[model samples]
Target chain A: MALTSEKLAEPVAAPALAEDTPSVAIRNLDLAFGSVKVLQNLNLDIRQGEFLVLLGSSGCGKSTLLNCIAGLLDVTGGQIFINERNVTWAEPSERGIGMVFQSYALYPQMSVRGNLSFGLKNQRLPKAEIEERVNRAAGILQIENLLDRKPAALSGGQRQRVAIGRALVRDVDVFLFDEPLSNLDAKLRSELRVEIKRLHQKLSNTMVYVTHDQIEALTLADRIAIMRGGVIQQLDAPQTIYNKPANLYVAGFIGSPSMSFLDAETVESGGTTALQVGARTVPLDGYEGEGPLAPGRKVVFGVRPEHIVVTDAADPAAHVTATVDLDEPMGSDSLLWLDMDGHKLSVRIASDANYAPGSTVGLSFDLSKSSIFDTQSELRL
Target chain B: MTDATATYTGPHGPKPKRRLSPTNIMLYGTLFVVAVYYLLPLYVMIVTSLKGMPEIRLGNVFAPPVEVTFEPWVKAWAEACTGINCDGLSRGFWNSVQILVPSVILSIAVASVNGYALANWKFKGSEVFFTILIFGAFIPYQVMIYPIVILLREAGEGISAVTGTNFRLMGSIWGLVIVHTIFGMPILTLLFRNYFTSVPEELFKAARVDGAGFWGIYFRIMLPMSLPIFVVAIILQVTGIWNDFLFGVIYTKPDTYPMTVQLNNIVNSVQGVKEYNVNMAATLLTGLVPLVIYFVSGKLFVRGIAAGAVKG
Candidate 1:
């Protein structure tokens, strides 16, 4: 509850758009290696100055899709438009995009200043202009003091800063980041995550980031595209993806300690719809979904740990009676594992509250926040 | 508890090693024998080379010279004869320089480009080309000697017909240079290819995204980062071409013979008072170039080889 309040404290203002043209667009993008399809029929439109994140577990084609957008990988069939220009067949440099890699691929032999200026020099930019751009980038990255040092002479975070400075000096319209902070330790990862979020706010360039960490996707992305098996499972704003997951996978993936599922059958009596769980019937009032709940239909009731309340006394009108199986006390809160009939459920409570094993407790469910899905299709209904 | 604490005196740490334990004896004994086995011949050579002919004829090859003289080294440098040229290895030394310089430069330059292309900018059929090139490394050099001679002769004749001049590669120093360059290519290319392949792919991709073309990446990124490997290639080619005797004797005439071939001539000539000191001095002189190169860049050679070994 404290974490939710802290998250709600900060307002995420949507960037206002002056024009309708998307900065980068991909249509029917298809990529494969020999015969193994990595990404199939993928489509995306990144609005100007938008922060879009491609999120998934490993080998889910998120990085592959970022490479495709950067023109690093040759697509099997598709067209990519950058700022209204067809760049599917173009070189990565010609796509007017700057990219940062996870390995901090700054030139090892070159000084940080040389790394920033090498690209400009290759483009035949004037020496003064190159110097100016390199200095400006170094200043913005706060790496001006480390300019003369080689990459090996710097720490991991400093080297990553130089890598970002290398991209920042290009002044491209779009920025592509391929898990740029995945190499850092946890503390540095969180620090750099905030730095990257602040960077996006300052630059406001159309940025596409790739990461497998759900916390990163939730914190840094304006809109997150969750991918699985080379397909986009759902694409929406972070809060919407959290509160209103489109499918079972999205609901399970975006939460920590994950949402628990309970098998139930829909029942109707006297024009009142309810769910029968084991031997107890819970009212299905205020439930939001696509269609009406019919009697005798098999469905799954998914609920998050934070949405359930445990009462000391077993009220007859309570949702279900559960026995306290185990109690785990985390620093800020405690998680109670309870057994209802033959099913297991986890509920979050304040850390100070402790329950002994074998104690009977009544649980109340928040009907408005819970989800009901078709048992066979696993889709929200 | 006080009695227990007072009596407690267990061993605190690891047992100290003796200076001459059985394992140490066996290890150092084997090492000493190997060192003597390799170094004894060089020691004998050095002692014999510094002694006079009279001292050498006394039959004690290991004895230090009563009176040391630089005469043998001087004679080997300026007076010893190879065929009709009495100029000794001096002439052949210059000839070897011509062949060695161009051969080392050309072979390393071309092989490094071949490696960079194969490792990074892979074209269609590059693996097949690499396979064939590496395949050349396994073939015996003696088997290719005759065919290479024929190829050189035909190339010379074709050039003579076109240029309207007496142009021949059959018995010239340039002919030997080309042979050494071609022979050095396969192994040197493999060394460079493996080294370049071990460089992270992300750096190459980063260079490409930075607008670096093929040659730009080669000169700015690949070339600078690969200095250790280049030192490795240079050392391999220099020593291989400089100490070559078979190619020198077969490809070039006596006037253009390399130092090794001329040293052979001076030592194995049919009619001459055998000069043991001169021969030893000349043999040492022939090996000096590669010895100096190995000592100067030995550390980088190990690092380069280790780098190549990692990914392959």
Candidate 2:
């Protein structure tokens, strides 16, 4: 149970000690079933000890990619490297990765201890060593009391913990999780999510997690790989992916109460760049990008609901007036769906902030925090 | 009791009657009729088997024996003649045991492995063979009996050709076992296949990820979880092979005749005066194995059959 840093580092071979050698490197991966192409030339490099989450909705190849990395799936045309060793044709167990499934696939007929020790027994490990590993895993997961119980007798949370313990006892270099918390209730899911994050912190082992829940992706991933249509849209830190999405799809897909988009035209007035929406022109200040904003370029402007602000005594040059069409009073904040010159936009405010339907309010779009994409390409500009 | 106003009934209230309701009467009445209908034959068999030969001829079958005896049972088991074998059903019973034990084990072993392969490790043309086999089950044995006899004869001739001596299959209990196994294949395979298919795919995948191969997963996970269906298959095969008269008569020599055929020959032989008491005892004895199995496996038989029929 006392898994010190040195003990956890016992499995690393000396040849893999080179700095900058990625823990898992996937190159030009292609997968297909019959005629349907699921993944196409996908490439990724997972750093050592990094928690990388492959995040997307269903049918996006996130789980498929994780399975390929774990050697559970055969890639049609590609090479996979783990710790600088080519393992594209290796067996799943030989790949040195342990997986946790959404169903918590524990052996139903075995006690929790038996389930944890089954693979070790299959490999014919020494009895005392297997016992020590199992006890340590049970202690780490705090499932010592549940060790004697069958899977059917445990609660959902306890079963999932045992499933994690099964992987932990394997003493693998990487852990693959395929929506492990999806089957739990909301309360258990959040609690287990925190525990998983803590586990990652304590072990500092590389983890490749697959999830459709954006909260899990954002909170747990050191780098979140936002995928769409079998391609990695953006791979960056959580805040970077959130604030500066690579494309329109990533921007639209990441947030709850999704970012509102408005049709606009990029125009240059004097020497400053500004976007004109309907009759109002908002200055684009501190818009960090590569090139100058050309005049007369059609674009779509995006803003999160919480970033739009309403103020009566506003800077006349910055504030744009709109009418509140609907007000939704959430417990801590109110979402005001406003009519900005016939374009619908939503603004988030404190729950106690007074605002009524049909009331005229002065709304300001913070251009510094907003995103703009070219209309035709749908790429962030 | 009088202290509680809620429990006290007014004097003017209608008197409560304790007569059975019409629904209860109808339910119990139908159940009693069904029970009598089912038990009537067994009742007659036991009573008739206990009576003296003269007494059975004089009284109705529903009447109990005036002079009770177990002589008919003893004669039926050890002394009754079946085509000059006065050793009675004992030889046939042991022959059936020889056929039943091996047939049940071999049939189930082959069928379960076939089912697991069909359900999990699917190869090209496996399904075609399975489809043909299932359709083969619907064809009556009478249509294929002659071909099977010829096949066995040719197989024996092939061995004779190689070994330079007569190697007979037509007069052996092994031939009858092979027949029962072939006939019992379709339904048993279908039972095991559907049951294994209903197991969660994720569990199988997880086992594979845990370094389990085909036999490993089957022995460690699938086999343990499928005990009920195996019991169901055992029950089906045991009863089917034990009571099989057609295959027993067709495949084996008279020396290796199973209990059902021997019982038929002993009771229905036209040469002697009819002994109703002895006939009833032999019939009961022949039916005893399946009866004991059905009684002991009562609830599990029902559950297993239902489980095999449906998928989750």
Against the true structure, whose DockQ is highest? 1
Instruction: Tell me the deviation in Å of residue B301 in model 1.
Output: 1.8
State each candidate's clash count: 0, 0
RMSD of candidates 1 onward, in order: 5.7, 6.6
Fnat of every candidate, listed in order? 0.72, 0.53
| Candidate 1: count of backbone clashes, pairs at least 3 residues apart or interchain | 0
Q: What is the C-alpha local distance difference test score of candidate 1?
A: 0.88
Q: Scoring each candidate complex against the real one, what DockQ results?
A: 0.73, 0.59
Off by over 4 Å in 2: A1-19, A313-319, B1-26, B125-129, B159-166
lDDT of each: 0.88, 0.86
User: What does chain B score (TM) in every candidate?
Assistant: 0.95, 0.91
Q: Write the per-residue lDDT of candidate 2 for residues B157-249, one digit (tens) a residue.
A: 888899999777777887878888888999888888888888777787778778888899899988998888998999999999898889899
lDDT tens digits by residue: candidate 2, A101-202 = 999999999999889998888778999999999999999899999999999999999999999998899998899999999999999999999999999999
